[model samples]
Target: MTEAELQQLIFDGLRKIAPESDPASLRPDQKIRETLDIDSFDFLNFLIALDERLRVEIPEADYGKLNTLDGMVRYLLAKLPK
Candidate 1:
């Protein structure tokens, strides 16, 4: 999937976890947890939702790489099947 598609998928997952969040206002370089006030549990659920939607396993070690919108898109772009 393209970066835009991945970004949308991430936003969708975030919506499910944090309904109050305004996806459009999210900064690409900002940390998602801090921006959304997402606790550990919510973040885990968001990751699970993304994994289910994208059919990709995001290992724990890579979680740091997904902390920001731009980072997540770049990480997924590299990991996603060709």
Candidate 2:
């Protein structure tokens, strides 16, 4: 998928975890969990949701790389097929 599409997937995942959050308003350089006020469980669910949607398994050790929107997009793009 394209980068824009990947970003939308991230937004959807975040929305699923935190319905009150405005995923579109998230700062690309900021920490998504802290910004959304979500705890670890919710964050794991978010990542799992993204994994299911994108068919990409994100290793737990790589979780830190997904802290920001920009980072998530970059990491996912690298994992996704060309």
Candidate 3:
């Protein structure tokens, strides 16, 4: 998927976890948890939702790389099947 598409997927996952959050207002370089008030459960759910939607496996060790929007796109781009 293209970078823009990956970003949109991430935003979609975030919205699923935090419906009250405005994904467009989130800073790409900032931590998503802090930006969206995403608790541990929300974060996990977001990851699960993304994994299911994207058909990508996000290992627990790499979860830290998904903290920011930019990071999430980069990480997913690398992890996605070529």
Q: Work out the TM-score per prediction.
A: 0.93, 0.95, 0.92
Give per-residue CA lDDT, model 2, range 1-82, as digits (tens). 8888888888888888899989999889999889999999999888878888888989999999998999999999999989
lDDT (C-alpha, whole model) for all candidates: 0.87, 0.89, 0.86
Tens digit per residue, CA lDDT, model 3, 1-82: 8998888878888888889988878778999899889999989988888888888888899988888888988888998887
Where model 2 places Cα greater than 4 Å from the true spot, the runs are none
The stretch of ten residues in a row with the least summed lDDT in candidate 2 is: 45-54
Cα error, residue 78 of model 3, in Å, equals 0.6
TM-score for predicted model 3 compared with the true structure: 0.92
**Candidate 3: stretches off by over 4 Å:** none
- In model 3, where is the ten-residue run with the lowest total lDDT? 7-16
Report the CA-based lDDT of candidate 3 relative to the real structure. 0.86
- Candidate scoring better on TM-score of 1 and 2: 2
Using lDDT as the measure, name the better of candidate 1 and candidate 2: 2
